[model samples]
Target: MHQVYVLKRPHVDEFLRRMGELFECVLFTASLSKYADPVADLLDKWGAFRARLFRESCVFHRGNYVKDLSRLGRDMNKLVIVDNSPASYIFHPDNAVPIASWFDDMSDRELLDLLPFFERLSKEDDIYTMLQEHKSS
Candidate 1:
């Protein structure tokens, strides 16, 4: 493949579809747009993400890239970020839902494991408080 190619994580489309039904999903990554945009298209061909943010949105802090969710123009209490990298959500630990890094794990069901919680979480009055109480890292 001379062109860059991306493989969709197993069941990720279903996961995104499920999450999309509950909340306004957003794609926030530290990857440069040139690379990330195409990957995003493949990952979200169903158009699950309500917004997409790229590397410019990241903050270079302490030699690690940090995603500042505060700039998302939304209430911090109602926001959640699921990422494999701790550095991505270091600025808002309470809002982070950590996942083990996956590489060619075709049988992975990490996304499925999260569905029930998100289903319940969408109804909560405050996500931040709920996340603190649940704290699954």
Candidate 2:
């Protein structure tokens, strides 16, 4: 149950960085088609730092919406998709929990609260344990 955090905005980086301090992070950055060479150059420079932060991280340069979304959901069932707008378009179908936060309005404490559930799902045996607990209750 490796938790994959899909970050969609530039401003969300700060919050993502804070989360990385506590969890194993796999960051998904939007494509750089609009920015072209400049964006590519920046990613090349930033690649090293991104690599060091996680067990693995990748840049999705192709904005194949349907394909990427399908892959993301398949890769990890336990995901926290963070976005600045209503993510109902994406999360509604997958049953993923979306956390909406504006750059100026978001708080670190609020993000930290979700860590426990994310960590629990990342464990292989937690599903059965959770079911057992649920049945007993």
Candidate 3:
């Protein structure tokens, strides 16, 4: 058995709260349920997330965990995935925003920094087009 240190990203609480206000927030991670659940419960103490998906939800693609947003039971046109790695969203690149990976970096503000952009996206009728524009910019 191995122990893992689950570090909550900085400003994650505020970020999740803000996201919850604008969208139906969901927690999707490649971590195992045993590992990710407690961390998520702690981070989402205010119940920001509407749903949760764990490692089983991801596909083992080419030695990597790939998160296909199409499986979320929601309309793909309205979905955007904020992942730390672009590889995770290779299945649907147009709906991806590659945030910087945070490995216990207290100074990292990637999630917080994205508030303005995400806020704009919240107003967009089609998240796919906005994500595409973001990728090209």
Candidate 4:
């Protein structure tokens, strides 16, 4: 048997709780369901994710597993993806909020810092416009 230990990101619970309240949050990952689902279940205690999408949901392009967000059947203008890997959202960079990948940095507050921005984002009509403005600023 193989046991794995997962560390929750700082303020991730708060982040998920708040994001759940404001948006129809979905857990989308390129990892296989067998691995990611259990971790998500452990991390998401508040039932934050309305849906969970696994590796099969991704589109493999140029040797990378790209999350083709258009397949999600949602309004593109309202869609937003928060991910650490740029390649994951290469197909829809306009809708993505690129985050730095986490790995054993206990002092990291990226998720916490994003709360206010996400709160503001929840009110915007066009996510692309807001993201573009955020990128420029």
Candidate 5:
């Protein structure tokens, strides 16, 4: 099964920059129409790295909490939800492991702090190996 990584809120860019290095990242933006113009303007100013990543990514929009959870249910065991919120707050009663941010304000250094957690999760889940097998067969 393909491991699903759901990124929430402002962590979209950070998630893209970081996870893109190790995993195929699927970014769930709230609504492209809602912020398309502004986001585009920002992208023009900020540069196209994120835009490139966004283009070569899976985007899930127009979803509610229940809908998101249901989509995640298809591969709950292989899903890892990353957000800036506390893990306790983001974790549902259902099976979900959240990769919580370890800092008040997210930054490169702060994201680096999550490397250990990411390595641990990736090791435990064997997502890369599983994905390779699935792809090969």
Candidate 6:
């Protein structure tokens, strides 16, 4: 593969830093590790992620790569996935905290804006109910 440039989303470093302090973070993506790992290494300078899951970790279902949260051996109730792709969490939508995809918008504050919501989530005992309420509002 050729060399590629990965742009960091605005405030992503801060977001990951704060989230790491609050929760046992995991970097899960549909991307292959060969590409995603290096980018993650660059982005996660603070060692935010406890684990990094790549494409092989996902299940190919209905033409989409679905992240099987059940396979993680973690408590489902405490797990929350913050992803821009809904297909990634098709198996466990209730645990998802939907985020918009970032592009070249340097002015975007989506990641920074989600900190408060995630902070509130860190205190919650039931993720399903909180995420459902979050989706509704």
lDDT for 14 (candidate 2): 45
lDDT of 2 by residue, 1-137 (tens): 23333323343344455455544443344433333333333433323223221112222233323213344534444434433333222422343334546344433454555455545645643344543443254
lDDT of candidate 5 over 1-137, digit per residue (tens): 33333333344455445565664433333343334434544433323233222211322333332214334334555655443433222433233333444434434354455555555556666544543443254
**Candidate 1 segments whose C-alpha is farther than 4 A from its true place:** none
- The TM-scores of all predictions, comma-separated, are 0.92, 0.39, 0.89, 0.96, 0.42, 0.96
Please provide, for model 3 over 1-137, each residue's C-alpha lDDT reduced to its tens digit, 9 standing for 90 to 100.
66667678899988988998889988888889998887888888678889999989999999989888889988888888888887788898887788877787899888888899999999988777778787777
CA RMSD, predictions in order: 1.8, 10.3, 1.9, 0.9, 11.6, 1.0
| Pairs clashing within candidate 4 | none
lDDT of 1 by residue, 1-137 (tens): 33887776787888999988899888999999888888888788678899999989999999888999999999888889999999999999888988888889899998888888888899999787667766744
Candidate lDDT values, in order:
0.87, 0.39, 0.85, 0.92, 0.41, 0.92
Ranking by TM-score: 4, 6, 1, 3, 5, 2
| Candidate 6 ranges with C-alpha deviation above 4 Å | none
**Better candidate by lDDT, 1 or 3:** 1
Clashing pairs in 3: none
Candidate 5 stretches with Cα past 4 Å from truth are 1-15, 31-33, 36-67, 72-74, 85-108, 126-137
Better of 5 and 6 by TM-score: 6
Better of 4 and 5 by TM-score: 4
What are the per-residue Cα lDDT tens digits for candidate 4 across 1-137?
55668998888999999999999999999999989988999999999999999999999999999999998999988999999999999999999998999998999999999998999999888777779887787
lDDT for model 5 comes to 0.41
Residue 34 in candidate 5, Cα distance off native in Å? 3.9
